[model samples]
Target: MTQAPKADSAALSTDTANADGTADSGAETGTAAPPRPTPIRGYFERPLFDAEAIRGLQRVGVIDVGSNSVRMVVFDGAARSPAYFYNEKLLCGLGRGLAETGLLNPEGRVRALNAINRFSILAEEMDLTSLTMVATAAVREATDGEAFKTEVEMATGIEMRIIDGEEEARLSAQGVLLGWPGARGLVCDIGGSSMELGEVADNTVGRRATSPLGPFRLQQIKGGKKGLKNHIRETLTELRDKVGGDHKALYLVGGSWRALARLDMERRGYPLTVLHEYEMTPKSIRKTIDWLQDQDLSKLRNRTGTSAERMSLVPLATVVLRQLLHVFRPKRVYVSSYGIREGILFEQMPDDLRACDPLIEASRHLEEASARTPGFGRKLFDFLMPLYRNAPPDRMRLIRAACLLHDVNWRAHPDYRSESCFDTATRANLGGMDHKSRVYLGLALMNRYKNPGSNSRLTPLLSLLDPEDIRHANMLGRAMRFGAMLSVKGPNAAAEMRYYPKKEVLELILDPDRQALFGEVAQQRFSALAKSLGVSTKLRVARTAKLEVAKAELANGEAAKAETSS
Candidate 1:
């Protein structure tokens, strides 16, 4: 775990360093220098949002003034996967009595104001130029909403934008898209006083509809359980007709939905607790809804670590979700941890940033921040491309992500590094990945350190992938294990690999000058990789210049005639 040496900043800027550590300076030679060779970009290096476009968003603060809670989230770090630099929520229940009385709850208003004031002060201390604040449902519908808005402006010097239900729905769907750029289907966001539905497809939000179907509002309805069920059914029926029912997946947003998902996970003893991409089938949802009817909510809350405030709303949300499932009849359901706060950030992003894959971008950011050699992941992916030349686009993205994240846990103790990598791949706040992909990536990373047959404790999770997936994961891990051994600089600096699947041969051609670098450990790992590929291995040594010439000749459809030594 040695640290890479810091480059001389002056030399790094003024002249390019040759492989032999000599400076290439045109002024010293009295002739123009050759153009620098452009580094090969990996599949994950597709065009991203201009760094300058989001420079100011590095430390953005967003306040979501919802009916049930006032939450302030200060996003920092990578724009695509912005870390929660600061996050705090105060349950104000601002829409508690709004259904009975067309006014904001007096007690809830005070709490909401104090919460906003506290967030404003915190933002000032954090040196944020301004905070993006938006209020949903309750505030927009309450009669005194205007007065509260003015009071908030006067007290905290923050102008709160009270968005209509349609806009709120749109933003919530965008937040889903922020985490799942290719997400298509319906987004259902349930707050305290209102529930909004937005349709999404092709990375854009379509029609949106909102209803007074929130728990707080449902509680005020004259009907008991039976009456509430009827109202929910009718409301969702209308919403389905308005928003269309062709959605394949339903993305649940907001606290109550998350609480329901958590309860569902607890009921099923789900292994991976990360909720962003937690999936539930329609049958499972119905069963969980039925299962909730028999359980003691207080005990369930404790077991699932749900707050009393949020858990109290779960029953009403459950009714809505049950009906939502019935009306939409989606093929799948997923819980999205992202909501209006993340949506606010998504709204500010340029189109290019919106288009970037959240998972790959986040992985790239992790590599840049944590890997010993920041850019080695790209080289590793390129080095391994031959093994996966025929892989579909979807699987290729996961392979690319695995390579980028393969070495980020290098500082962990040897005994726990594999487990740590597995945990990170499964539980880290990575977006755009489903549960199965999480396990696949985890298995690959685990294999990066330890060989196969060592993940006994991870057997339950391993069930997520099939035999072919397991084999592919092992091959990826073994390839990385071999490639990482070649050079601390990177695999490309020491050798290049060629894999012939049909012929069952895996060849490693080493740089003649660096052949000594392929010691015992490297050979053993190379043999393991070959074994994983079920191929025979060949080792060759060629001069660096001759290797380059051979590569060019091969590219030009000419036979390479390099001098090789076994």
Candidate 2:
């Protein structure tokens, strides 16, 4: 395969060209060109990506030429939780008739070429030197696939890599791991021409296998539904044998699965619309699949805003899913918005970069970009650590993420900042967050601005969390609210908080020089925090001596007073 040339530094220069396409050289102008400013690194000027890991690249683009659609995605910002800087897709149906004929669909080929051409131009305009293009089952298995690849390169000067079935399965599973570093399951990705099954566990892809069970290929099977059912059953059984059936969860990837997940959400009247990390049970999936058979798909399509092309494949995909549930018997099912494209990005990440939590990285990026004090989130987390001393690792990560994102929404209007924070936490494109974690984080941020009442509009989302989670969220929020009042500089600058849980006392040791910062509002917020913890508030001024010395003196004085009273 021919590799695209590396980006030329001169191509990114500010120098202008003349009308005749000749460069206006400084030598010819008899004047020196001004020096260029240093470029800001990372997304929103945050240095999240290691300079060596990405080879000093700021942005990367990937093109997926699948059986049903062709999509071009340009990823920017943090590599772990990359932002979709530019995304466009066309339902080209490149494998619509591949089952009948050994060649790509004539019309679909034309559309795919046109889409790729436009993507090529867009990449050039965006100053991307190369795009990593991958062609899946449709093109890889077609008779004219290599010829079509040659034509694409001739037309757009972009080489397309035709990956094999196992590679495709591996990449799809890796995509799931990009968002869920600790995911352990069977990843089922259904495209227009084929379906792949890959086992993932312990942050790596295990056994992988591909089958001719795609909807389009199933459509060509004789004997109608009965024949299709038998074919699917046999195919899935073989896949199960090859990949094993020990997986407890099934991670669904690709458009057809996402469409099914969306319909499941609509049927259940789920409040949150965000699709990534949306979980479904085997029973719920069975119910939704049955219900989909009777509903008017056209009306449902319009209501759910699903494209006609994607909806057309849903029925066939649903049949596969039904058989899949029966054969695999997975305890849980999850929909992943990440796919082979994200997997390609993950493939390039270094081991250390891959080890970082996507949610924390994304939250840090948000704080750096929008918070009043960029580094205050870490300080806030430390100040509140006394409250969560025994928190589990999972809970600790969420608390850390909440601290990082606590003040990113301070720019919203005062009346709606709480709601804005809630919406952002619940809907933002942060990976590694499940539905429940989202609500918990959102509630914590909501309480950061104001007390959430029973009649709050976001009350419905509270159902996802139990009483304990809700209580924890409130305490965390009130802790942040009180901590923020301590200093505009940061929480650490104004006071040190010490919670004596056994004594039922929440103590605030104020800095002698910063005593003026403890205003009426600060005191009220402190009281609210103490009330939430069912503890009394204790205020003390720190002496110029060490904190341990002050604590010793106070303890001795209390002990002496108790002895004298006795």
Highest lDDT: give the candidate number: 2
> TM-scores across all candidates?
0.87, 0.88
Q: Between which residue pairs do clashes occur in model 1?
A: none
After superposition, candidate 2 runs with Cα above 4 Å error? 1-52, 547-566
Model 1 TM-score? 0.87
Per-residue CA lDDT of model 1 for 473-529, tens digit only, reads 888888888887788766766778888888999998898777899999999999999
Q: Where does candidate 1 have its weakest 10-residue lDDT segment?
A: 17-26
Score each candidate by Cα lDDT: 0.76, 0.78
Q: Which runs of model 1 end up more than 4 angstroms from their true locations?
A: 1-50, 452-456, 543-545, 549-566
